[model samples]
Target: MLRITATATISLTVGAILATAGFLWADRAFPPPLPARLEASTEVLDRDGLLLRAFATPQGRWRLRTDLASVDPKLIEMLITYEDKRFRQHRGVDAFAILRAGWQLVSNGRIVSGGSTVSMQLARLMEPRDARSLGAKFRQIFRALQLERRLTKDEILTRYLTLAPYGGNLEGVRAAALAYFGKEPKRLSVSETALLVALPQLPERRRPDRNVEGARAARDRVLNRMVSAGLLSEREAARAAAEAIPERRLALPAYAPHLAETALRNAPSATAHRLTISRPVQSGLEAVALNAATRLGPKLSVAMVMADARTGEILGSVGSADFFSTGRAGWIDMTRIVRSPGSTLKPFIYGLAMEQGLVAQETLVEDRPSDFSGYRPRNFDMRYQGDVSVRQALQMSLNVPAITLLDAVGPARLAARFRRAGVMPQLPPGESPGLAIGLGGVGLSLRDLVQLYTGLADGGRAHLLRDGTELIEPSTASTDVLEPQAAWQIADILSGVKPPHGATQRGIAYKTGTSYGYRDAWSIGFDGRHVLGVWVGRADGGAVAGLAGYVAAAPILFEAFARSGLALQPMRRPPAGAIRARRADLPVTLARFAPGADGLTAAPNAPSEPPPQIIFPPAGAHIDLAEGTAAPLAMKLQGGRAPFRWLANGKAIAGLHRTRTATWQPDGAGYSTLTVVDAAGRAASVSIFVE
Candidate 1:
């Protein structure tokens, strides 16, 4: 009985001791590894499921994974050499190497070289951030062992290769290859492979172009290790060592980084989807912008953006390189940042008014001067253009006339116009009067402005804008913004402006804007296919007062549009309204202008064909009906070969001024005929068939 009892106590004590050791092992090992998040809802596409951009998501981060076969072998070889020598031969953990590592720890006193295997390194890389504890480590060890038992050696290596970061902002060999060499992983050469292979250890430092010497040394070490391990023969290492290394040209690292970063931010699942950004377009645009900025002089910081006009998805954007695009992360993303729109907004304002039924394309309004809520805006040149057609004022970019139209259309209504175009333009926060509308005090992103202008290019229809093709859907949701007549009217006006045609940008009808003191210079135009917007001037928000719209913004717009294949066409003019007939009896440059009231302007001998006029506002709205008035009104007129005279209510108003009002008494009351004749003999007249 005594012998049996002693044996039972011994067994208990042995079990207890074993339990303690197990506890200690658990303590030493850590938690389960966390894999880097691979998918971003905003950036990933089904077509590009293997290439995801990262973002915070509920289902955990997913690393975009491509076929292991697609990865460059040099990259695989690099990770294998740096991480584990006997990766193919080991189980989840290499016991012999573990012993050696234990000995090294005993002698050297810290966890340093040659401890973890490739599987271990990959384990650390993939481990969840929250699960990085000793107990979790042990748990992960078991999981990895399970992985080893279930999966082939090649599968483990493949996962490790796909999940590794190569350099810079690139998280995978595929991204790194394109980021560095602007090519695909399958196309990488030996020297290129070596450079890429050496990058995983320290992506920033090992960039061959930036630190070629360090990269070469790191690569040589990798090759020597491979040789020592008999993975490759001496002849192979010799040839690799002798290969020519290309000198790295330091392309600006921050080149449109803000653009991409903003895109990723706006695209929620971008990080997870491993967003397949068009590196070529990004790189090419940077180059194009750089040349433009340099030629235009550094005093100008240019922003050029190209988007998928059909869907409003910004394919690529180039903000100012002077700050973000040239170097590293900064405080601002200028592309998305807002600025005043200046004259570039006129087409939309008029286009919307025309579309909304607030005004017709043939609607005649004085372009001379506008008096509204204590504001009278002058043209850019500070001159009154007098009696001009809606088309004439737009083509001339007459500031006063645009303000008049805005007053008539109502600022609140204009704000609504911006929203309908897929642009939440920053208007005056609260409802005020007309103070901010015509002055351009409202802030708007270049992105928003680009989207807003799309309505014009799309011929009165609007679509929900997207960031990429993935976000687009087949929809009949398109709504009309303007009558085809009104849309064409504004488009023609923008295209017909003087010498440098300050308005038209791309081969498509375009418009230019100059903010106060030339703080911003802009050119936006479209051809048959593309819409392009170019912004130039100071990023510092300093005055570009002396700078003209033609200087940089317009030229760059033209150049980029040409390069991108937006062909210019003979623009279709606005709807017919006032007509001027070239009569043999009048001055050679003189012609007759006649209003199309009840089809009068179309009559023969009226001289020139009816001049384009506001037919219908693109948007589907109309203002309250106003009875025809015979009140004689004084006016100034523009758009003929020269300036013209005015007769209102069937009476001349050339020198008529009385009280706060200057009146032109035409022949009768209610609505009467008004007419104007220019020095060059072009005449413009409208009939008010009174109620």
Candidate 2:
């Protein structure tokens, strides 16, 4: 009897070894057809990892990649407790759960619960099957064992989270949370966690958006299970069950659509693209752009961009007011489309002049009807402010003055400066930079103009703007657009200009431009840290009558700054040698801008006379005025023809005097420019400071 019992034990052990060997051979011969790779939707995330935009997979499914850490801990705990209590201990299938299910089925004459572990569910998700019979269950068990051996516990969990269906084309917890709750899964309330945990079972039937009652019931079941498992208290379970389920799914985040598309094109194979955008700022600016476009007209589109001046990082960009609107041709990215830039290029012209020491803020410059080699340039109003100060010309955006300065500085030089800053203005096929280039004659994109303005904001240093598409690290290399002092001077003048009507003053340096025929309107503004550019126009290049930049785009620019949710960074302090001196305080040669030989045309057969020269209040002189009183300074000049026009800082004295000597009341000055223009148009000037 002992020998027979020993023989039976040996036979059982041999059978057990043979069964294990067979199982291993089957596993290797028919390895579960696990996918080599999972396809996930492409996502564009902001700097803080907030979703900015997401593109659907080729199969039209929303399968966002899921990370275990990004999901709420409560959801995981509740899911494990309700779905598979022995999930951690089991390799693939839970023996105790299978036995309990079998006993319940036999006693109740029906299947009461599933014996499948989380690993089994993940296997089924990876390789779907239509059959619900014993054969399908065996297949799932086999595949689950293979997955367990090949992947870690966390890896299996994450794959399950990523592939689990949640109604419609939404696959994965991240997509489900974003659709139902309009937020990420990183932070969810107890009620939200319960809903997400229960959705994978009968996803379509329990979808909250389709059947709120069914979803609520499923969520309540999850909460109850959590309580039974001691994962949650009864009171907590009840509170969670009482919460309302979302009746409608919200749309996913879709900000910066144009920029998102650009990123996708630049990196076609990347599953996730991270950008420097701030979601809140992008949302606010987009709203502002849409509202402005709607108010302007049905055919007009609006575009905007806001960036860090020092770093050149784009914080927000709106390619169009509405990406789906047909009337405005919203599909076009207006920010990158080349269009006439109007007077937006004027600031750079003046900046170059200042850097070259050709003009000062108070330098008198003629703004009359003029012809540059038969190419006549006129102000927007078809009227001119004769003999205006350089500061007034720029603040008023006078076309004649800008052209005159551009001519003196040479349009080619201005274009070179723009190119140095990584912006190339589009010109006519055969035309070089001409006087018209100063007044909307050249084509440029809104982005190009903003890049140029960054120099002014960052003390003459211009950085290359980026939206994170480049593989290399952000570069600190910058191009010099102007000297520090010259840039500061431009910023100071722009900051002093009044804001558009009905807009609050923001203390930002801004310039506005109107293209010829009123086809385009532009406004660019900046503080010390950030720069924002706005463009308003018909996408078809049709003119919108009376659509001037100040009236159309400036208001929107101001509104964008206000809505951007960022505090207005103060303008930088003036650099060394950067001082705002009155016209009279300028050097004798700089007191009045004398155009080059090419810019000036001598009067026909006019008598030549010695140029007028200031005698009293000599150049760079300082005089003390009586306190609390309007004190007049005696000014005198010699030579030149008379019926002389005495001017202080470009404004004519009350009346023309035949006598050279004249008395003028100082405008409570710190610095002043006194000038006299002779009958022959010859002029002399002096700068003085009055205490």
Candidate 3:
């Protein structure tokens, strides 16, 4: 009777407990309450709507972003297949995936599979920019749910593919495609597509440059998965596995470093939409920098910037070594930093002074040593040339007179003008003293200096480079910033500026600058279309020193200008009205001409006989020929014994050996003038246009 009574009670208790448990289980819910709303930092792009770069904050670095449509599809497929096979079917986190993950946790020794959906991963990647935490993970999941509700599966896929990091500073598939195959993602072959897919799994380790074999193996493994998933055929998978991948990407920068330097600053502005930086011009500039650096050898580094004066578009820029060289980390954009501008700053000060009526074009100024508040400035040679006119001082970059002009203009106002012109530099309390400002001891970016010069070229008006294509809307700057007449006068001076007698006939309007102790060498010159700023020195970086300070660096500047298509705009030429011809002016006195005539290598002591006459294409040349077609525009003269010499583009012709006839051959795609100097030193000239 007692045992029956105890068993009945126990059974009753068990039944009651079971009923309560069932009710509790039915009432319980998953994924508790929601948290507060979260916001993400938005990335800004170039005028073309291309992402310029992103940073954690203002203090952080400007990180470059790769384009979308650049990544391989295989990578996208791999993540979806491995982590969430039913991602397309689920709203956000699949219930089945979660259930499977639970089973995996119990059955497997490690958390091998994640139930987290693609949307969840993207949410985390975009926000907090932080490491994984339980709370953070939950927040990510919540955002994923919101995203799933907001966007379609296709949109989610597109967003994920575009924003995902594939490795090597690449932000999207489009960038990966360009980096790996130098092509667009749509053009990727199955094998190449598979390789890019594998990189994101372990970016640092699988970087193609580091572990080509490992990346390939990972790619093959992913291909197996893709094939099994029926995205690609088994035959396709096999072919991809067997194929060799080209493991290289040319870091072809879309904007020249200088252009980037100029445009990036104004990205936050409303006008950030009109700037148009040309891709090919930028590539050519980069190519020049790289080739120059390589040809000079690794010990020397080069930074070059080329730009259009009218539009303010930087065509090419390079900060570090050439892209073709190995082991270069392009973290530092060389075209931005404001090095001591050297003599490069002189022209602007001269122009400003000229504009302010502080000095006129031909006003006599002293190039000899001068003092300001006990601070005296010396030329690069640390010596002085006696009294020089205002034009000569600027043309020769005469240091003492520049200081005198700066003293006259007052550094504070000039500094203000510099700021207005977009030059970013620390100006000494203008009230203090020195000629260093004129000498470019004032640090300013390459872009700022270029802009300053462009304004001078454009008739003393400054314009900011807005971000996009609306170039016609350049914000107007100070009017008459430079007097048109004075600026013209400076231009004339520079055209004829050089050494003892005259300047080189290249006729480029240029300025050579050297900072204190020769730490920097810069040459700023212009043709009608563009103004080129050439800075030569170290990139891994060091002060411009020794030979690099002078001979080595100066030639590079002149060479680049010569090679580029800068024309020496004719300054209001000297009136031929003041001159008359002497009957004897044709003879011995021809060689007795005054200094400053560019490219006048020789003059006849006297014509022993009738001079040579050009046989082909005549003087004002305009003709076309396929490359390497030799057309020696010959000359026939009475005296054959005179050594035949020729000049092309103001330099000596490569192959000339006394023969009376001179060949006017086309070298590159351009026009050149030929100067004929005979054995008797008699000279004649001709111009040829060749295509």
Best by TM-score: 2
For candidate 3, the lDDT comes to 0.57
TM-score of each predicted structure versus truth:
0.57, 0.85, 0.48
Using lDDT as the measure, name the better of candidate 2 and candidate 3.
2
- Per residue, candidate 3 scores C-alpha lDDT tens digits across 1-691 of 9999999999999999997676346334333222332122234344354433233324332123332344455555665775567888887777777778779979996776677788886676566445656788667766777677667886677666655666656655666666677766767788877776666556677777667887787788878888888888888789888987667655533444434444445554432333354455444555566666666556565666666666666544556555334433344555667677777777767765544323445445657666565887777667888866666677767788777767655666677777776665665565342456777768776667667766655545555543243324556444334444345545555656552222245655666676665555666666555666766655444553462323444455555555544444543332211112232332221323111122122343544566555555567667677566666545343342356655443344556566666555454554444455555554554545556
Q: After superposition, how far is residue 481 of candidate 2 from its true place, in Å?
A: 1.2
Question: For model 1, how does the per-residue alpha-carbon lDDT over 112-206 read when each residue is reduced to its tens digit?
Answer: 55556766656655664474456865555565665575567887776666666665445556555655675557777665677667777666777
Off by over 4 Å in 2: 1-8, 470-476, 596-691
Q: Write down the TM-score for model 3.
A: 0.48
lDDT, candidate 2, 267-294, per-residue tens: 9999889999999999999999999988
Q: After superposition, how far is residue 180 of candidate 2 from its true place, in Å?
A: 0.5
1 or 3: which has the higher TM-score? 1
